[model samples]
Target: MIDVLVAGGGPAGLAAAVHARLAGLTAVVVEPRTAPVDKACGEGVMPGGVASLRALGVEPAGRELRGIRYVDGVRRAEAPFRDRPGLGVRRTTLHRALHERALGLGVRIVPGKVGEVRQTRDSVTAAGITARWLIAADGLHSPVRRRLGLELPGGPRGRYGLRRHYRLAPWTDFVEVHWSGQGEAYVTPVADGLVGVAVLSRVRRGYDEHLDGFPAL
Candidate 1:
């Protein structure tokens, strides 16, 4: 039996497995997707998150971000980090790094979706695997949480986030946030010649429609 069973292979699940191993526990992670998974995210790891990653001895390659900058068509503002600079890493890169570290530490990764979960007073079983404890880091719509009747009610319509990568050298060391009338665009440099742009908006529109307002981007 495993000491811990993680129900996802995302950052949170992998991190939990690493921490469990560090604490002298045998952990297994069940995920449907393979390694180096990609997802839409801001791609900016805050200074504290970076430190936490370093603590686990897992450092992914990426660009160093010095600060954050906000700009509208007329006004601009910038703030430098008081402590360590943040890291702008792609989601795939981060996942691969964490996956490698977890494997090196002897964390078993099973490839399969968790269909059902059962728990007793002493152990929890998921996907036919039993463990002393189970961590449900499956995501926003976690199946495990839903099965356990732990899901909360849905909130109001929230802003949608869309991200895309461009093969262009970064113009600045800071994450640039451009605010338009409809949405906000976050530009982050994830690699030497690659930048990731994510737009968050309540209005439904294509990426081109959002970028049309920020011609300088």
Candidate 2:
């Protein structure tokens, strides 16, 4: 049996597989989505995360961020990273880097979802595969967690996020966060001529409605 069976192909799962291989353990990742999966996120990798990725021999091409900037109407604040610069990368670019790193380390990836996991004292089984250990990195609403009765009760409605990309040059080398009463918006430079904007709010509304909260963006 494989030493590890990762139930996702996202960054988390792929990172787990990479770590497993780095430790001389065999790992297999199961994911239903295609390679280089994309997701709605701010797409900014902090300095520590950048260090960790470098340690794992994964370097993605993107803009370098020197610090974070916060904006509230006319008020603005900036904080630079003390040691190392962060990375502003697209989600798909980050995923592809991690996926390629995992593959280079001999981690096998299969296109499938983990469902109805069966576990015992010694091993775990799911999706017609068995491993010495199973990692449930599927997502926030993991089906394996529910099938194994490990899911917790739903919490109150919280913030939702939406992200979009603009084909324009970034104005600064720092990630900018715009704040308002309703929600917040994050602006990051993901590429040479690409910028990503992500909005987060607890209120249920359209993306345009959420963007309206951060008019200064």
lDDT of each: 0.92, 0.91
Q: List residue ranges in candidate 1 displaced over 4 A.
A: 154-159
Error at 99, model 2, angstroms = 1.1
Per-residue lDDT tens digits of candidate 1, residues 51-118?
99999999999999999999998789999988899999999999999999999999999999787888
TM-score list, all predictions: 0.93, 0.93
Give the Å error, residue 139, model 1: 1.0
* Model 2 agreement with the true structure over 1-217: per-residue lDDT tens digits: 8899999999999999999999999999999999899878999999999999998999999999999999999999999999999999999999999999999989999988887877789999998898999999988777777777887777244578899999999999999999999888999999989999999888878988888788776
lDDT of model 2 at position 116? 80
Tell how far residue 84 is off in model 1, in angstroms: 0.7
Cα TM-score of candidate 2: 0.93
Give the poorly placed runs of model 2, Cα more than 4 Å off: 152-158
Report the poorest 10 consecutive residues by lDDT, candidate 2.
150-159
